[model samples]
Structure formats: structure tokens, C-alpha cells
Target chain A: MKKLILLSLIILSVFCSCSIKTPEEYYKEKEKGKYTATISINCETAVKYKNSKRKKSEILNNYKVSYNKGDTVFTALKNACKANKIQFEYTGAGDSVYIEGIDYLYEFDCGKHSGWEYSVNGVFPSVGCNAYKLKNGDVIKWLYTCDLGKDIGAVK
Target chain B: MFKNFNPIALFIYFVYVLFISVFSFNPIILTAGILGAVFYCLFTLEKKSVFKLFGFCAFMFLIITLTNPLFSHNGRTVLFFINDNRVTFEALVYGAVLGLAVIEVLIWFKCFSTIFDSERIIFLFGKISPKTALVLSMTLRFIPNFVSNFKSINTTQRLIGSDSRIKRYLNSFSAVITQSLENSVITSDSMKSRGYGLKGRTFYSRFRFSTRDIVFIIISTVLFALSIIGRTDFVFYPSIDAPSLSGFSIIGCFSFSALSLIPFIYELKEGIRWKYSISKI
Candidate 1:
């Protein structure tokens, strides 16, 4: 009883938000492997395409990028967007990066079910973009589906 | 427990803890305040009361966590979506932390209410403004008295075979209203009969300050000051870039921890002493 308060106090203070090194520092402290991935925005089948005259080659394509082993899909896609000049809009969630739009094509812009969806190795990741860390030879696709990812063959 | 101390010490201690709970948004400092409150609750309150508080806090925590992600879709990570809006883990975690901080502060107030009863509150405020103190004390007394009266009336009705809960509640409510009206009339009559506010009116106080009280006041005030001075600036949203602890923050954390745990420590020491003395028999 005498030391109960004292012990708990010490534990609480230390466990408190005193410090969690930045992701950069964390990776620097540990050995990291080199990895490469491919990311591209697919919007050829968006509902807007039926009425617009924009060509498929101008809107959809592939991007090859390299990232550190622990780099998330969000980071890789972000870097690829920077390199390729693709417009991207996102919001931050604690661990998940919330993707709202790509190339000015936002969710619900094409239709009620149209939005951005990401798939790794042709499978839609159940987790958020930032939550899915990149791996060697990973294939990431940004699919824009006007029919709830049905147009991009990504929803199922 | 708080009443045993000089009202000065009690007031200073509670104010400091409450301030820290409100201003210190960091998860760790907030957690310490919460742990301090939890310890206070565990030591002073019944198990049922503590559990009830915990259940309420947990429910609040869930609501905050689930709802924050819906409105503020800020974060690099998107967990899921409702319609076109993305729900992020960052917002969820942020809400949970904020919710925990609020719950901890509320529990601290609960502990405050348990320790600083009306008499102590009146004593604390009485010297500054007599009328204010009287009103404050009476307000505190009226609520509990009204509740207890209602309960008793309901029990009597139940004993007389009124089984409908709704009817009993309504009956009790009306009975208390009538009782309050009668009480106000009698109270005014008694006050008028005694010439309460007449010239040469002077009030008597039972409180006596001791050397221990002086020492306690000085210590608590100084420690609370240190805790305030040591508090660091923090921001939570957009990203978590919490600065590492410096000397001042460390001092604040230690002092805050020490200040909040005072009651618990005092009670524990007294319990040990009493047990030891009893064992001699």
C-alpha cells in the first residue's frame, strides 16, 4: 500500500506519450530491405467515360516504384503519384491512410457507387492503404469503379 | 478524507488535479490523472459504484471512437467507409484518447464530491461570502434530501401495495414537491421568527486551523504550482508529433502524480497504523 501510488505513478509517467520515435528513426534503427512495387490509377470504365471524349491511355496506366520494406501502400502510391504527376487526395487516420480521390475523380463523382479502391496482387486489401506495408514485387492497382468496383474487376 | 485537511489544502489539491485533467491533452499525463482517480475510487467508493462509473466511461469511449472517424476523415490510413466518406483509424484512436481523458476528469469530480461534502464546501467558501456560502450549502443539501425523501415515500407506497413503478415514481415526485413547498414555508417562518439578517448578526464557525494544516497548504500549493509550470504544449490532430519529456514536464508529471495520490496515501497510512495498534491487543 505504501509504494502502490509511487509505483503506479512511475509506470504511468513513463508509459505516457513521452516518446515514440518517428517512423524514419524507427526504420533507421533497424535494418530494412529494399523493395519494389507497381501502382496505377484505372479509370477507363468510370461512368464519366461514357459521356466524355477522354482517351483510356491518358487516364490509366502503370507506375513502377521502389520503397523501403516497411513502407506502406499509401507511401508507395504517394511517391508514385509524385513521380508520375497524378492528382491524389487523402486524409490521415491513425494507421490507415484514407484515400478520397485520384486525378480529380472523387468518390461518387461518376455515379453513386463510383470511388477509388486499391488492390494488392489483384486482391482488394481489407485494411486501409497505409496499413498495408509494401513487400518485394508487390502489384498495387488503383481501380475507379462506377459500379462499386465492378467496372475494374476489383470489388469481388 | 478531504475534510480532515484544511479546506485550503483540499481545494488546492482538487483544483490542480482538475486543471491537469483539462489542460494536459497528452495520453500519458491524462492516463496518470485517470489512474489517480481510479485509485481514489477504488479506495473510497463501493465496488458497485466504481463498476458503474467504469461502465459509463466505457460506453462513452465506444461512442466517441466509433463516431469521430465518421466526421473527421483525416489520416493517411483509411480503415473503411460509410458511403463516399472514409473512416480512418487515426480519428478513432484520437477519439478514444479524448474520451478517456474526459472520463478520468469526471471520475476525479466524483471523488471530489465524495470527499468534500457540503459542510466542508460551506467552510471553504463561508468566510469569503456568508450569503453565497449559505446558498451553496443549501443547494447541495436540497438535492440529496429531495432524492431521499422521494425514495422513502416510494417505499411507503410500495409497502402499501402500489406495485407499478411508473405510478410509484410519479407519486414520489409529487409528494416531494409538496414536502418542499411546506418546508420552504416553515423555513421562512423560522428564519423570520429568529430575525436572521438583523443588525449585529454574527456567525460562528467550528473550524480551527492547525500547524499541520499550514504545512499541508504550503506543500500542496507549491507542488501544484510546480505541476502547472512544468506542463508542456501539445497537439494531437493531423499527426502525432509529441515532444519528448524535458525537465519541467518531468517535474510536472511527478508533482501531479504526487498531488493526486495524496488522499490515497494518507488513508493507507492511517489504515496501517490502526491495524498495527489493533494487533497489539
Candidate 2:
């Protein structure tokens, strides 16, 4: 009985050591908000892919996020993701920031014509996400399209 | 095992395994590759040294897997976040696979060096280009020779009660480099005097293709073709999914395992046969 108890304790300690540690909070809540914007991310078209990572059509609903002046749509998305713990990945830098993947769905994942695109106030800008500066109370919606923005109602 | 097969057969086997290990990202293939490399290394190299090599490879594998997600955040299943960057499970798996492929190739090269000595190298490459063969053989020979020479020089200096440890290494390294340069000049001169690289030059090699070699080559070629045809299409970004195991892929996996284990199986069979013959005697 004593040996059994000792063995169980050792095994319990091993399990404890091997178990993954809960990751600490990464982003701190901002103290002040100079401006606020509304953002939403959806991958409705990803339903076509059988093995997609999307759990639902809407990955992130309209979340209100605060940002400073000169913040781009990309910055707003990044901050919102950080605050909400949503996984977001992007390539390029500054005004050229291109959202490569979000919530595990990446570009060209569904098909060659599939990718992530965003529109501000129902207007899809010609420039990249980081280049499009966010205005106060701006409405930004990110959509995943299977046909290169054609399915998401974004022109060329 | 080396004595049982012709140099060409061994060369082709190495190429087949190396090609598969490099191109395939599937976990099944990589695991098979690691197992085969470990077993083959055990057969060729000292058991102690094999363990040490594998220990180092395992350490490197762990380091790559853990550190890969820190720089790239392109996976769906978020394990946790590090400084606002998402450490996804996908990137970690990708890194692990990448590391495995790297160490697999490295161990196979270790097997390559053990199997292909200077004689086999020349025998394999001599028919195409004699000059290149000579250069290749000489260079391959020089690396081990240089290390041994450095060790002897370092030991002599140690006996002489030389300077600091670092100083001894630098001195030995310099001495080895100079000696290698002089040795290369002499080798080139000796080859020139021997009329090497001349047209219609006949080379001597003991390696002869036997029926055994033909059988081994055919088996290896067939396995190689199967592996290529049934290769895995694993996607690592945005999310991780189970490897789609089609009929061809399952066959490919089996063929790959067989291909990698060929050397070990041959060695084991030969060992058992020798034991049986001795028991009869």
C-alpha cells in the first residue's frame, strides 16, 4: 500500500510537469481611447471547404475597439484580435500589411481564388489594409471569399 | 551489408531514401525515415556513437519545434499567446516536421559516408569524369585526415605543456591547415606524374554487379516509385488536419518503411544466416 501510494504520487508529479501551462494574458487593456471603430470578420464562403478551420460563418462579430489617431484598419483588426485572443496573421509591414490568415483560415486555402478581403463602410478600398486609415466610428468588415472577392460582393 | 551489395546499388538506395526524406512533409514518412536512419546507423556505426548522434538530433528536433511558433503565427488552433503573438499548434507541427526532415537527411549522410569509402566513390564517379572523381575522393579523404592530424598535434602540444586551451586549438588548427595544403600539392603532383585523367585510362575496381544486386536494385526502384506516387499532401498553415490516407498513400507509407529498412533487414538476415551456418558446423 505504501509503495502504491508513492508510485501514484510520482506519476501525478510527472503528469503535472508534462501538462501544458496555461498561457498568461498577452495584451493589456488600453487605458484611454482617442477613437473607436467597429469591426467584424466572417468566413461564410469557407463553408464550401470540407475541412476548414472555421467553426462558424462568423469568426468575430461586430466588436468595438478603441485606437489612436492615424491607426489603419489593419491596426484596428490587430488590436481587436489581441484583446479578444483571436488568432490573426499577416505579412508585409506598415501600409503594405496584408492579412494572410485569420482564425486559422489562410489565403488560397479553399482554392486558388480564395482569400481574405476587407471593406470600410461597404467600400472595398483599392489599397492594402494597413494603408486604409480608420476614421472615428468607421465600420470595417472582413470577408473570406472563395472566388477572389467576387463571392464576397467586393469588385476586382 | 556493404560487402553484400555493389557500390551502385548502395548509391541508388541512398539517393532514393534521401529524395523521399527531403520532399515529403507527412508525419508518417518522416517517422519512418527517422526509424530507418536510426536502425541503419546502429548497423553501420558503433552503438554508443549512434545513441549520441540520435540524442543530439532529438535535442535539435525539440528546439526547432518549440522555437518555430515564436516567429511565425499562422495557425488556427491557438495554444497560447506570447507577447501578443499567437503560438498556433500548426506552426509547431510544421517546425517539428521540418526539423525531422533535416535530421533525417543528416543521418542518411552519415550513413552515406560510412557506406561510400574512397574506393566506392571513385568506382561510382570514375566512369563519368576521372578528374572530378579524384577531386571528390581526395576531398572526402582530407576531412577525417585533417581532424586526426589536429588531434595528434593538440595532444603533442598538451604533452609539451603548451599555452592556454584556446591557444592549443588555434595552433593545432593552423598546423593542420598548412599540412593539408602541402599534402594536396604533393597529391596533385603525384597524380600528374602517374598520367591520370588521360584518355582510355583503365581503372581497377572490385565492385561487380551480381544477381543479388539486381534483385536489391529492382526492389528499391519499385519501392521508390510507389512512395512518389502515393506521397502525402499535408497542409500545415491556418490549421492542422489529419493526413488523408488514401489507398495509394497507405501503400506508399508501407513501401517507404520497407525502403528505409532495407539495409537493416539485409544486415540482420546476413547475421542470422552466419549464425545458422556456424551452428551447423
Candidate 2 versus the native: TM-score? 0.79
> What is every candidate's alpha-carbon RMSD to the true fold?
16.0, 7.4
lDDT of each: 0.74, 0.85
Question: What are the clash counts of all predictions, listed in order?
Answer: 19, 0
lDDT of 1: 0.74
lDDT of 1 by residue, B69-136 (tens): 76675555555444334456677778887887888888888887777776787678756765576667
Clashes of 1: 19
Off by over 4 Å in 2: A1-32, A38-64, A69-73, A83-85, A91-99, A107-156
Best by lDDT, which number?
A: 2
DockQ of each: 0.02, 0.25
Instruction: List TM-scores for all candidates, in order.
Output: 0.61, 0.79
**Which ten-residue region of model 2 chain A has the weakest summed lDDT?**
A18-27
